[model samples]
Each structure stands twice: as C-alpha cells, then as structure tokens.
Target: MSEPSAGDPGALAARLAALPDEQLLAVLVVATAGRDTLAPLYEAATRLLSETGQSGTAPGVIPGTDMPPGYGPSADLGSSSQVDSGIGAVVGDPAATGGTVGGYTAGGVPTFGSLRDKVERRIGTAFGARQLDRQTPAGRGTEEQWEAREQAARERLAQIRTSLHEGEGS
Candidate 1:
C-alpha cells in the first residue's frame, strides 16, 4: 500500500484497516519503536491469552520481546506458570497473591481503585480539608485531631484485615 499523505487521517485509517490485526500491531511497534516500553505490554497481551488457555502469538510484540519473529505465533512464551498477570486480576481470586488483603491491596501499591475515592481525596485536599498526619505535627494538625484520625484509620484497617483473614481461613 502507498503511504498516506502526512496530514490525511482518513487515508491513514484506510491503510491501517487494510492490514491484518498482527500487521497493525507491528506497525504500532514500529511507530513507537522502543523495547523497554513494549516488553511489558507484549508480555501482558500474550499472558492474557495464555491465562485464558488460548496460546498464540500476540502481535504487539517487538523485536526484543519474547514473542517469536514477525509476531507469528506464541508457541514460544514458555509455560503458563511463567506468566504473571500483574496486579489487576489478583484482587478477588483466592489464589492471587500480593493483591488482596481484606479486599484492600496486598501491597501498598494500588494500580487501580475506586474513582470516587480518588476524586473525593483530590477535592478534599483542594478545599483545604485537614488530613491526618501523625509523624510530625507543628502547624499541620493538632495532636488530638491527628490521634483521632490515626485511631480511626487503624480501627478500619484492622476490621478489614480481620475480615480478610477470616475469609481466607474458610
């Protein structure tokens, strides 16, 4: 296919649509052209398929990725045991490790969470709402308020931990 003119979105779309899915992904790889960035994406795509018990080459893979040449087929991604589904799917599953504890994240790192909570926190801070800080308190918050907030947070956290631990026991 002939290259689309620099400013023509319609032509570019047409050209992209003409190729198969694999070819389209290959084009994307070339456009971005970076190994460090693409490797995780490639791994995730290929692992998603494998986790669902369908093994095939995922087209998003570039030259440095584990996927085979030309992104033909994924028969080479090793065994299913080798694939880690990152942090997303681990939230609710019993076997998922380092993802859930009393429905809170296993690790402090939360890749995704309730949008409302994020928005509320953002708005709260923006509106000059006092946040709980215990480690150091001179001008930020009074000792009483800090202690109260800290106690409340700990209580809530404990309840969640207890509930999660109970769930695991059953």
Candidate 2:
C-alpha cells in the first residue's frame, strides 16, 4: 500500500472507507485477535477519525481502552503448584512466614490467594468494559472463552514440541 500524501487526512479516510466492510472487519479481527496486534493501528485510526470530527459518521463504534491497574505491593502472584491445583498447599507457618491464608508456602512465602486475586484482577482488567469495573456474567463468559483459547494454544505448542522431539529421535 502506498503512503498517504502529507497531511491528507481526507485521502486517508477515503482509502479506509474504500475498503470493503469484509476487509475492514478482517483487519479488525486479525489485528484484535489474541493479543491485539493491531490495537495501536486501530486506536490511531479511531483517534484520527475523532480528531477529524468524523467519528459520528464512522461505520461502527470504536472500542474503548481501559487497562486495569495491576495489583499493589501486597498482591499475590500464584506459584506453579497453586496454579495447577487451584489450591495453595501450606509448606510453612503463617506467623513465621507472613503469608496470606490459602497461599502457597515455599521457603516461607505466603502467596496463594493474592495470586489468584491478581489473575482474576487481570482477567477483569483485560476483559472489563471501559464503562464498567465489574464485568457482567456474559463478559465473564467471554473471559472464559479467552482462557480456553489460551489453554488450547499451550496444548498445541506442547504437541508440536513433542512431535519435533520424536521426529529428531526417530
């Protein structure tokens, strides 16, 4: 694609508008797929439209950006075991270790619940609507779908690795 002429916002808009809805939607989908690779482009395009005062006439709404703040100093990040089991196993004393209740205990570190909380928080932050802090049940369902997709990716990667190793060994 050729670059737009300098300061030719109209030309740029025309180019984008010229794209078929399917192409535009494909661009949006591929860009927003998984980790949102096209997020910056999408953001820039939307901002361009808004700055040009043309957003009102844009085809659809531009999604909002609202990254949830991460956990504070006391936020717990779960351990490997805790993540697998969904339960923190006590390996030490709370008084001596200062670990949170239901957290993993390895080398006297108490950090299970906080980790889970952090993950949940991140899930909320990443998936939460800009307009709402607490996501609705349907939104939560979307998050679950994302989780399942992530798991599937991991499984596929593992399978690929195993196949490669077997091929090499054979």
Per-residue lDDT of model 1, residues 55-144, tens digit only = 332223342345323122211212134345442333222134332211233232333322334666699886564444434465345777
- At residue 53, candidate 1 shows an lDDT of 42
Error of 2 at 134 (Å): 5.2
Q: Name the lDDT value of residue 135 in candidate 1.
A: 41
RMSD of candidate 1 to the truth, in angstroms, is 18.7
RMSD of 2: 24.0
Give candidate 1's error at residue 24 in angstroms: 0.9
Off by over 4 Å in 2: 1-128, 131-134
Query: What TM-score, over all chains together, does every model reach?
Result: 0.22, 0.24
Which candidate leads the pack in lDDT?
2
In model 1, where do residues sit more than 4 Å from their true spots?
A: 1-4, 35-170
